[model samples]
Target: MQDNKIKQEIEDVELIIGKIMQIGVLIAGAVLIVGVVALLVQGDGGYAAGAHPSRPLAILAGVAAFKPYAIMMLGIFLLILTPVLRVVVSIYAFIKENDKLYAWITTVVLVILVIAMLIGYFGK
Candidate 1:
């Protein structure tokens, strides 16, 4: 009886995690789309002020801004798969009630993405 109760609790936790992941993916997708549209509106050139953003500092700043938006799009792409992974992990966790490895994995991927974005932005 105690084991059955534990199993039920685990399933509930997994269901909640899966739902959270789905919501996260949806939110990420929305942000990605909005960011892309904003970037596109900016055009290939500099600001609308007609200053034509020259100089190393200007270029770096421009790239830094651009990279994050681009990376967000990548996140949108990943989110599509991530939610699926989350669902699968959630199921596994429910069955086994093991360590929270999948959560950590998701966080690590996000961190790596952010770091890559920073490097792309600043390295430019």
Candidate 2:
């Protein structure tokens, strides 16, 4: 009974992770396509580099201002974050399984992922 329960939980986690990745990729791809189409239609496909945002929030502001580059960059950002979120789901799965060792390892991996993101954002 216990073994079957664990198996069921593992299967459920796999399903959830698969769905998460699929949705993330689809959304990112759709946004990228739209941005590309917008750029192609405009013919120039260029923006003033001086007006480009230096951070995430600023990039969001740029997107709100209808900057094509920012929109495409946001799609790229979503693509990058997809795997990071997979690690997050894995951490939860590990916790649910009561596997302390795996949970700790996943937590460390999550921390490392976050550190890398912070460095990428701020270590300029």
In terms of lDDT, which candidate is strongest? Answer: 2
Assess each prediction's global lDDT (C-alpha) against the native: 0.60, 0.85
Best by TM-score: 2
Regions of model 1 farther than 4 Å from truth? 45-72, 77-81, 84-88, 91-124
* Tens-place lDDT digits, model 2, residues 10-121: 8999899999999999999988887788778775434664454557997687678767777788888889889999999999999888998999999999999999989989
RMSD of each: 8.1, 1.9
Report the lDDT tens digits of candidate 1 across residue range 1-124.
Answer: 9889888888777677768787878876876675567657765333554343333455446546764344344545556556656655554563465556765665566667667756866785
lDDT of 1: 0.60
Q: What ranges in model 2 sit over 4 Å off?
A: 49-54
Q: In candidate 2, list every pair of residues with a backbone clash.
A: none
TM-score for all predictions?
0.44, 0.89
Query: Model 2 residue 11 lDDT?
Result: 90
Worst 10 residues of 1 by lDDT: 45-54
